[model samples]
Target: MVDVTELEQRCADAWPALVDEPLGGWRLRAAGGFTGRANSALTLGDPGLPVPQALDRVKLFAAAHGIAPCAHVVVGAPVEAAVADARWRVDVDHPGGAESLVMTGTLRGFATPKDRAAAVAGTPSPGWWELAAQANPTTAQRRVLGSGSRVGFGEVEREGVVVGAVRGAVVGEVLHVARLAVRPEARRGGVARSLMGALATWGLEHGARVCALQVAEHNSPAVTLYRALGCAEHHRYRYWVPGA
Candidate 1:
């Protein structure tokens, strides 16, 4: 079984925040409000202080950074209870859905798609950025998207045009996958699966054996696709905010 705490830490490392700090074992992250994962406090472990005190620091950190005070907490975990006891309620208005699932699969066992032609590259190509960003990427988005120590970018092209893109980062033996996008015209094809395979191959060479990803619970299509790839939910987490 995957260790939830360790896996969360690796996920954080893979998709790093531009400004991250440690409050004991807890991670306070901020990335200019780029994405929820990069901008929330990861309340997964002990903070070496009273839970209430740690919660206070979380509020101060977010206030100082001009981002909403949010906590990335695992559902049913001890920290979740502690956070709720401290009166931090779930953020119903969270930009990203309030709940998400972290799924894991062994890279070697990932389903093989027929069109495994996503070209893997060490650096993101212009076309890759075009599809992934859908517009000029902000400085914070660019930094976080390209920040991992061992990152691989994958894209599929057709008729000299990019149709799909994905990003993967390797930390320890796990490959953290994110930012998968497929052009509307290319949907229902093997583009997504191909991208996953290509990135998995790249991740293997970079010392990753398992693949992990976070997807919103409400994204049925994504949930179905990942399930088809033999991924199983390792855990679920919710975003919490200061309660009324």
Candidate 2:
């Protein structure tokens, strides 16, 4: 059986926050509010304290980090029930959304023909960073996306302009893919699929077998593409915040 909890932890490490602290088995992460995954508490296994007490710690940690206290709770996981029992409700306005899916699959199928392949590099190109951030990237975005141990940055160019970009971070045997972006004028031309293929190739060279990604439920096009790549939901997580 695929251990969803273990995979979740691996993903967390792959997308590391600039400031990471542990509360027993849980992770309290912050990265200048760059993304919810970085700013929220990862509520998984034993926290080494009562759930309520642990949540108190989460609150304190968030306060110190200058972000709201939010717990990353997997749907149907025991910790989710405990957190809900502790009176924390969903953060309906979470920037990422209320829920997201962690999808996993092998890298073999994402390969594209060489001619249509994206160019993968060990470092992000200036254009890649700009497209991924939609602006000059904040330090947090740059660090969190580019600071991993073994990472690959992929991009597709058209008429001498970079039109697509993606990031892949290999953690052990798994490759975590994120930060995929394509210019509005570049969509519908298989730019994303090409970048994914190149990322998969890079991950394979780095000894990764499975690929994973997180996507919001409402992103139908992305969901469809990933599904076509044979990725399936390993688990789903939601952000919970202080509420009744």
Candidate 3:
């Protein structure tokens, strides 16, 4: 079984929560209403203040940014209980607001098919950002996807146009994957699989033995894809918002 505590810390390090302020130990993040992972406060360790005070600070910060106050709490963390006791309900309305699984796997077994022509780049290309995001990416979104010590942007091109795009970040022995997307016309053509294979190869080259990614519980297709690629659930986390 993957160690939940260690996995949590690894994830925080690999895909850092870009925050506006460090409230004691918590990360106060706001990313222009992007994914919940970037927009919510990540309550990892103790906040060095009373739970109420910490919560108050989070609320004020979010309010000032014209966004809802949300906290990303690991399932078994102490802050999860505290937030629940304070009547902060788990967010379920937003697309990625509910529980998400952290999946991890070894990269050695990933084999890129000879027929697929996937390439790994040091930075995301303009076509990659367009296809993966389906629109112009916000500055915060770009940072969330691209900012890391060792980041790889993988893409599969078809007829000279980028069709599939994915990102991988190597931190310690873990390679964190995110932003996997296939163009509408390129779906179901093994593009996603090719992209993953390329990323796994890149990860292995960068001294990463383990690969990890976060997927929403309701995304059955993506979950199935990752599972087929040897990923298993390491832990779960949810976004908690103040009040119902």
**What TM-score fits each model?**
0.96, 0.97, 0.91
Tens digit of per-residue lDDT, candidate 1, span 148-226: 7799889999999999999999999999999999999999998998999888888888888899999999989988999
Q: On a 0 to 100 scale, what is the lDDT of residue 177 in model 3?
A: 90
lDDT of each: 0.89, 0.89, 0.83
* Backbone clashes in model 2: 0
* lDDT by residue for model 3 (1-244), tens: 4476666666666665456577887878887776787778888778889877898889998988767898888898778888888888888886874999999998977756445678899988888988767468777777777688899999988788998999888988888898898888989988898889988988888998999898999999999999999999888999888895
Clash count list over all predictions? 0, 0, 0
Considering every candidate listed, which one attains the maximal lDDT?
A: 1
Rank ordering of all candidates by lDDT, starting from the highest: 1, 2, 3
- Per-residue error for 186 in candidate 2, Å, reads 1.0
Model 2, 179-206: lDDT tens digits are 8889999899889988998889888889
Best prediction by TM-score: 2
Instruction: For each candidate in turn, give its C-alpha RMSD to the true structure in angstroms.
Output: 1.6, 1.2, 2.1
Shift in Å, residue 47, candidate 3: 1.0
Model 2 reaches what TM-score against the true structure? 0.97
